[model samples]
Target: MSRLRSLGVPAALFAAVVAVALLATLGPSAVERLAVTGLVNLILVIGLYVFVGNSGVWSFGHMSFALVGGYVAGLLALPTRLKGQLLPDAPALVRELTAPPFVAVLVGGSVAAVVAVAVAVPLARISGLSAGLATVSLLIACSVVAAQWQSVTRGQKGLSSIPTSTTLWTALGWVLVALVLAWGYQRSSFGVRLRASKSDEVAAAAAGISVPVQRGIAFVLSAFLTGVGGALFALQLGSINPDVFYLDATFLIITMLVLGGAGSLTGAVTGGVVVSVLAEVLRRVEGGSLFGMDVPARPGLADVVLGVVLVVMLLCRPSGLTGGRELRLTRRGTGRGDPTREPSGRLTPVGAAGGPGEDRS
Candidate 1:
């Protein structure tokens, strides 16, 4: 019952949002495309939330996981003829192989998880600013490798002709899956202990919780989900390049997490939706029009707006729009006194031997 109650509100909110997106898909193709992009962003943000939210660690390298997943999925899903033409010197296994879209996605996520484990071992020992810098280094290393590896990733030329199998509905389905996984993990005992460690490392260690192990677990899980999002991203576009997963994407995803309240699942979802919509509007504005009116295009205007919004949000409400609280329909106290009680009324502590007026002999 308790678990159900915990999951219910978020589930309902997710369903409502998905339903609206589905309806939007019934409109023109542009609208459908925008909706699909928003859904994909939602998955990516949720993936970031899984580790960053629970462990309170900032990772600039997660986009590398997405890059890995995208490449893996692209290699598996691209036609053999195309692969031979584009990647003649590729590994014999990759050059000859082909896989269904679903299998490709799974394999991509699995490989990303493996890489994450390898990365997390060293990362788990560090925290705060140093850990963040380590992740940035990882991102740089991955970018260099991707750019120099001509045989597999085609170097800077990018990979194309990947099968487009991700529809709007498919993207939405993945978003829901990511959301449930993130929400469930946050409510689990592992999540509780991890959060404790996040709050105070010494106290958590004293309580017998292995901080490194918990953080590693979160890191791996987050990598897997982010990889899945990457696979979907490749399929959605039917193409990818090493640069696609670099700094711009990293900043965009981190912005979503920070803007939405990095501590809660609801915040991640809200941030993704709000940012994505705002970005789309800004993009249109950059095109020099509002409802078909002639307006001058201001290059970089969207980014400026986004930056200002982020600064204001940080200064005004550091906790995010939700204020670090989940959206719940019911009002339930923490098993303390009745909140509705009058202030002048006598207050009795729990486990008391007798009521206030009844003295114990």
Candidate 2:
């Protein structure tokens, strides 16, 4: 019951927010697209949160996993005729493949997880800014490979004619799943250990936590979620390009994560929604007059506005909108210092007082 209280309240609140968004945007097709896309972004941002939020590490490379998953699912789900027409020189296995959208998405996510394991081995040993830079290098390498590999990804032109299987309901379903998984994981032993390392690496190691292994687990899980997001993106658009998962997307995802309090699931959802809504509003206003005032269209105005918002958020609320804390309905004094502290700020071993099994409330 305590566990349910811990996870259910926040999940319910987040769902309410999503429900309101859906209702507000239901009539207009463009608005509906924005809502769906926002949900997709929510998934991606939460996927990012699983690692960056828990481990206090930045990753510029998760989008690479997204790209891989998108392409893998898109390629497999495309009609065989379309594949042959667009990717005539694709590998025989790829060209001959066909699957339902769900299966393709699963395969894509699994492949991304495998790649993540390979990447995590080396990354688990590094930390701080050096680790971030190493991940950025990985992103760049993946981008180069994606762009240069014409046969599989269709090169710069991108892969199109994918099945459109990611409706708003579909995206929402996955978002809920991601939310529950993220919340549950954050309260789990692995998540606690990983966050402990984030809070104090040497202390956590001294307490018998294998920091590298915990980090690797988070990385792999994060990659899987990101891959799922990528597959959903392709399903939603019926097309994808390597560029779609590049630097701009990276910045947007990071901004959402950072702007919401990278340490909390509530923050991830809030940040994704806020950024998505703001961007859509800006895009709509970038062209034509507002309030009967003549305003010329600005091609890049939305980006500029987003940058400004991010800067303002950083200056005003460095811990993000949620201050890195989960939302709870009941106000009980838990006697916990720094509610946002990773691993509940407890130094106890896994089964000891204030450990994973202890009642947080």
* Number of the top-ranking candidate, with lDDT as the measure: 2
In the order shown, what is each candidate's alpha-carbon RMSD?
6.9, 4.5
Residue pairs in candidate 1 whose N, alpha carbon or C atoms collide under 3 angstroms: none
lDDT of 1 by residue, 133-177 (tens): 999998899888889999999889889888899898788778778
For residue 149, give model 1's deviation from the true position in Å.
Answer: 0.7
Worst 10 residues of 1 by lDDT: 350-359
Q: In candidate 2, how many Å is residue 136 off?
A: 0.8
Note the Cα lDDT for every prediction shown.
Answer: 0.81, 0.82
TM-score of each: 0.90, 0.90
**Candidate 1 lDDT score relative to the true structure:** 0.81
What TM-score does prediction 2 earn?
0.90
